[model samples]
Target: MKGRLVALVGPEQVELHEYDLPEIPPGAALLKVRRANVCGSDLHIWHFLSVAFRDIVMGHEFVAEVAELGEGLTTDSAGQPLKVGDRVAAVYYHTCLKCAACGRGDFSMCSNAVASMGAPPTSPPHFTGAFATHYFLSPGQFFYKVPDEVSDAAVAGANCGLAQMMFSLDKVGVRRGTNVVIQGAGGLGLYAAAVANRSGANVIVVEREPVRIAAARLFGAHHIVDMSELTTVEERTQRILDLTKGIGADAIIEVTGRSEAFAEAIEYARVGASIASVGNLNVGEKFELKFAPAWITRKQLRIVGVLRYDPWYLRDAIQFLADNGDRFPFDALTDRVFTMDEVIEALELSESRIVSRAAIIPV
Candidate 1:
């Protein structure tokens, strides 16, 4: 079989190239890639904004159909339990089932974990990636069955954004009446806002982009703070404080990965408040930790950094979206779609802020 895949040849370089499919190994399954989403991390990797690597297949968030099963794999063509016709979303990570983290259900923290497609040959023979026309899958990792009520686009975004939101909320202890602030209203921010609202928090969204702020309101943000006029961190902090009646927000989820946003988060959080940092703050980037002592002594602020989520968390996120589909219009978050041949264009548009969430249909 021959399929097209987006390859990161070098910094700021990406191209769709054709490759011949390899043989499937025992305990492995082959999937026909249906749709792949351009993630924020994909943009970071493309710009060399991330750690370097040689030529690499650059997609992780994707959905597909079962095509074939290997010798030891018991599934039928279209992969037994999941018929050839079943539509599914692939989890992006693989972990050692016997590890301590895996035992604790923290798959993301497993020492032997690797990117779904980037795993070396020493790991799993068929566990390659979903960016191509057909890719391999390994055992022990979960593959979710996408419900009929969920659209392909919604599942693509939910694979990451929705799971991240649920993980952040769970980490920060958001409650029914808790006041929450989400920084930035991009793809992740919009999903976080909807998740926070559904969790019964009084959600406030802070975004510099007016267009995004307007969209945030439509996505269930109780208040939208236009950060355009707020010049200083102090000003932004004060604005957030004012919105929460000077008690400050009970929780703050930082999604922009901007240094200034972290500074403002530290400033706006009430003593003992929890801050979940989901954004990728550049390494070696210096920001004032002026409130460190106060945060520890007086406020007892709990600062937690988040990474990609566990499979169960992703499952819960899917259920959340499925249940609250009416309240949160997951469809509205998607700005456009392109074919697999237009993978480069999809990445470009996402980087330029021309679209919120973009999907690439590989089939």
Candidate 2:
């Protein structure tokens, strides 16, 4: 079969290349792309803000239908029955399950995280990335059948943002009656708010961008703190504290990808509260900020760093969206849609933060 993929030739440069697929090998499958999302994390690679992989697909967080299934595969990563023609959201980490990290159920930390997608173009499975007409699901990569009731847009993020956010939010304990302070209103932040709200927490989101601030409310943010009006770290922190009745938030999550948001998160968290850092995917971007270590010691706060997530959370993410799909406007997030041919324009708009989220439908 012949398919097309968007290749990252260099920093901020991409080319649409066509290639022929090889015969399906055992323990592998091919997915005809349905819709792939331009996640905030993609912007890092799009603008060369992070480590850019050459001759690879540029998009992640997608939902697709099973075009062909290989032998020896009976169920998804979540232990549910799988078969061709099923729409599914797969895990991004393609790990070797026997690794020490996988032995302890830490698949995200596995030694071989890029077993498949990192392969060269001449390899049998040439389609490594989701920004293509097809995606090759190699052996051991976890995938879950998306709920039949869920829409494509709602489950698109189930692969990354929603899955990872569900994992982090669960670890941080944003339970009923807890106050959650979300820093940033991008997909990660918005997804965090949705999960926290679903779990009965009062969600307060802080974002300066007007477009995102408006989008936050749709994602179940009970309160929105506009950073533009606050104008200073002290003002923004005070607004958060005031909303929390002076004791500070029960949990504060940083998803702004800003280094200074870390110190602000510390100030907004109450004693013994938990804080989750899910943004900051771009490693090279740095800023100098000062905060007393004594504050952490004095507050006795629990600070956690989140990068990737457990594979099963992808299943949980799909089920969560399926169960509560109507509570929040899932469709609104992907209203600004583009086709694969418009890849460059899509990346530009996503980086500019013109829209909260955008979907690229593969032609």
What is each predicted model's overall lDDT from 0 to 1?
0.75, 0.83
Local accuracy of candidate 2 as per-residue lDDT tens digits, 205-308: 99988888888888889999898898888888788888888888989888888888988889888899899988876677676767888989999989998888
Give lDDT tens digits, candidate 1, residues 134-161: 6677765666767778877677776677
Question: Which numbered prediction scores highest in TM-score against the true structure?
Answer: 2
After TM-score superposition, the amount by which residue 158's alpha carbon in candidate 1 deviates from its true location, in angstroms, is: 1.6
lDDT of 2: 0.83
Q: What is the alpha-carbon lDDT for the whole of candidate 1?
A: 0.75
lDDT at 320, model 1: 77
What is candidate 1's TM-score against the reference?
0.90
